[model samples]
Target: MNSGVFITFEGPDGAGKTTILSMVANHFKEAMVTREPGGIDIAEQIRKVILNKENTAMDPRTEALLYAAARRQHLIEKVKPALEEGKMVLCDRFVDSSLAYQGYARDLGIDEVWSINQFAIEMLMPQLTIYFDIEPELGLKRINKNKEREINRLDLENLEFHQKVRDGYYLLMERFPDRIARIDASGTVEEVYEQTVKMIKDKLAK
Candidate 1:
């Protein structure tokens, strides 16, 4: 059995997941906050290749595999070790991202994507997942407003693709309702943060 609590944050780009996670991290003194595709050195390198805007020719299967690879490295090098030490781990994105972005949105089967992730991480799964729900249009607008953030290849996808990504998340919620919590992401940062903190605290209490 795992010795620590593992929680993951999921959302469409600009759904305020990163910001809210940062604020919530401050509340948990023993919590470790990390993001996928680049939580460690090897994974960070793979992240660059996956997100590079110039790689427009990358295959969907190839993209999915790379993400799984990075996730495996991150788990081995950082996440599992921290969890073994009994730290609360708050991950920015995890296998759910592949299920959404690559599986449903890209027309690859969700089960297919999940199979690969399972091979990568074994049976390890988050105890709780906070999904920031928002309309794709609004989420894209939020992303565009952030001038300092790098525009990755996924950010360049058309609006329809992002909508499908959101739909995919909804489907995953149905599949794992007990594990995923939905929070409205259309409010101010403080409002969203408050909701997130409450959900997390409630989960911990249980």
Candidate 2:
């Protein structure tokens, strides 16, 4: 069986990852493009709860668990099946989001958060993860300028929290440099997309 290649895209909010993914999807027509927190029906419901602006009352651990729950359902229902069929699975976000947003930014300890995810994912990890690196200030500014972008609970967080999320991603980069490819996201959409496509091509060539 041709167990397919799994790739995930990650970055702080408003880094244009979703937009880039949509464009990338156009280029790779055969690839299955999806996003975490919401890929399948069950997970989409969880995504609504986790991202609702009214969910400001949610505790850190609760948020983490919710994301994990969504990830589990999405993985079982979508990701694994695509990979088993030898398709290129391109996900917008994965465990890295939890590790950054909840684990590091929320001060829940990466190892601790990882322990729970270990159960949820059962060690299923993407072969490649593209991380769009950006400054929190610029990212948040982009969010504010984009009126159409969903204003979620995480988007409302203070700059400090977002910075922590970026820092957390940096730590992860250090931890898994080989699997996680970092791309500067401060440029225009075309530039970022070009860099991303090059990275993907390089990985595919390997």
Candidate 3:
């Protein structure tokens, strides 16, 4: 049987990861697509509790642990099973988001957040990570244009926080150069999708 492949898409807001992931999922017949704090029933419930707008007073550690809990459940119930059966899993976000959003941006420290995630994921790292490159200012601009969307609390963080997230991602890239690929996302949807599709095909061919 072919070894299962785990690929993740990650970036700051407005990098069009959703759009690109959707397109790639449709094209890949064997792909099991999912997003963080979701993908399974239990995880989805956790996602609702954590993401609810009313929980403005939620503690940072509480939030970080919740994200990890959701991830653990999702990986156990959905991701690992698919991988065992040799299915390609295309995750929209993974542990990196935690290291960036909660660890770095929330001032939790990457090491602390990663320690928790280590327990959650047990080192089930993605085989490939596609990092969408977009400037912080442009990303926030995209959020501004989408007024209908109920913004998450993380979105309310200041530019400094977002910049820290970006820097964290860069640090992650440095740490995993062979596994991560940076793609310029500030292009036409067609352009970005085409490049991403080609990369996935190339990797699968290997």
Candidate 4:
């Protein structure tokens, strides 16, 4: 039997989550560093379809379900096996993104989206989640500067929707304070990294 810890990074687009996740994973890259819905081969293909900008006609529910489906495949093909082998699984984004973006931001209702996701993962949840906190406007500004970033179906959402996503994450933080830690992402990268490192050190120590 494997005994490993599962950690996830979460934040709105352009919140520097991917950068932080990369550093965190490097600290233990010998284990595993993965991302949702596309960490594995098959799931990556689904990721392309889901994030394609041409799919402008995609329904909200369809978007949510696609994310869930991709998550399921990633969990089965990558996350689970890593955990079962006692590898450190550091993932960039996970179920919380769905809860915040698709569930609340998309106005799908957290409970409703969660119910659908339950079928996808069989209730497997991340042991620890680091929420990178930043204002929606600032995050969007950052995203816009990165031309290479995928501005797809979800990225086209309005400011109001992004705000709702931030609010939704705050709600989850309050509801699951024990499992989710908030880090101020507005700070300098070094400052943010130090705070995150401290938080992880504390969690691991416990």
Candidate 5:
């Protein structure tokens, strides 16, 4: 059996999950820090296609499939090997993203998207998922103000779509309460970072 701890960070766009995750990674220097859809070379290529702003014609189901495909390669090339070596793995996103973005937000059934990911991951689920919660308006506001952040295809989605994504995450939290820890993300960066660090420390202690 694998011995390492697998933790995933998740949130709506501009919920600051990526920034907070980077800080958390610094605290846990020994952990393997990575991101979904772009951890390894093959996955990164797929990520480019999925996130490319020019890919507006991409179908919802196709988007979901591409995410699953990237996830599979990332697991094989990075996550599984690190876990086998007993290293703590902290990932920016994972299957939960596809479930929220493609499944619920895209109007596709969550169960349907989940079934596709099941085949790719084969039950490799994160031991802990830190979900940063924020209002869709605030999240989008932050994204628009951040010049350094890349404007992906998803970022261009309407406010209603983003709200749906947040709602999807809420549903997921209810579905997996035991595994997901929710944190208010509207606070300052330092505040969110502190909460995230504490959450990870608490989990590691367990």
Candidate 6:
């Protein structure tokens, strides 16, 4: 039995997940908000390499490994400690991002990527995961409109690849229906945030 609750927010780029997560974090005074690959010093260094646009030659498997490595370090340095202290840990992304982006979208085989991540996380899974569902085209449009947000390496991926990432999220949702909740992210930010809060509150009520 885990001592603290782990909740993850997952979505394709431009899905407004980060925006909503920030709002939700503020609402939950006891919650600790963090993101993958850069939540801690070691992980932040790994994140820089992974998101470097110049590293186009990086292999799909290599990208997956780097993400897992960063994830492991973040979990050790930040997430687990917060959880141990009985704080509600709200992470922006977790293993699902790897499964969707690298495993399915990159043609790395979901099962194969999952096996490696299993080793990284040591069976530590989120108690709840909220997936923001949106069309890939619309998501990209949102990203393009948001000039303030940094355009990362993943943002440069083509539309077809992003579509596959969305599909991968859906597949994972089917696999973990009890843990993953879908929220339509096409609406206004306030609308989406309300839905997110409701989900989190409902989960906590249980």
Q: Which pairs of residues collide in candidate 3?
A: none
> Tens digits of per-residue lDDT for model 5 on 59-103?
999999999999999998899999999999999999999999999
Give the alpha carbon lDDT tens digit for every residue of 1-206 in model 3: 23689999999977888889999998996799999879899899988888887888999999999999999999988888899899999998999999888988888999999999999999999888999988888888888898775587677778887888888899888988999899999999899999999998888888
User: Candidate 1 on 80-115: residue-level lDDT in tens?
Assistant: 998899889999999999999999999999999999
Q: Estimated TM-score per prediction?
A: 0.98, 0.98, 0.94, 0.95, 0.99, 0.98
**Candidate 6 Cα errors over 4 Å, as ranges:** none
In TM-score terms, candidate 6 sits at: 0.98
Of models 1 and 5, which has the larger lDDT? 5
> Residue 71 in model 4: shift from native, Å?
0.8
Mind sharing the TM-score for model 3?
A: 0.94
Clashing pairs in 1: none
lDDT of each: 0.94, 0.94, 0.89, 0.86, 0.95, 0.95
User: On a 0 to 1 TM-score scale, where does candidate 2 land against the true structure?
Assistant: 0.98
Model 2 lDDT at residue 103? 94
> In candidate 4, what are the lDDT values of residues 1-206, reduced to their tens digit?
44777888999877998888777666665658888768988889988998888898888899899999999999988888888987778888998998998888888988999998999988778778999999999999989998887676677888998899999999889888999999999998888887877877787788
190: Cα error in model 1, Å: 0.8
Deviation of model 2 at 54, angstroms? 0.8
Model 6: colliding residue pairs: none
Q: Lowest summed lDDT over 10 consecutive residues: which window, candidate 2?
A: 1-10
Q: What is the lDDT of residue 42 in candidate 5?
A: 98
lDDT of 2 by residue, 130-185 (tens): 99989999999999999998899999999999999999999999999999999999
Clashes per candidate (backbone, < 3 Å): 0, 0, 0, 0, 0, 0
Measured with C-alpha atoms, the lDDT of residue 105 in candidate 5 is 98
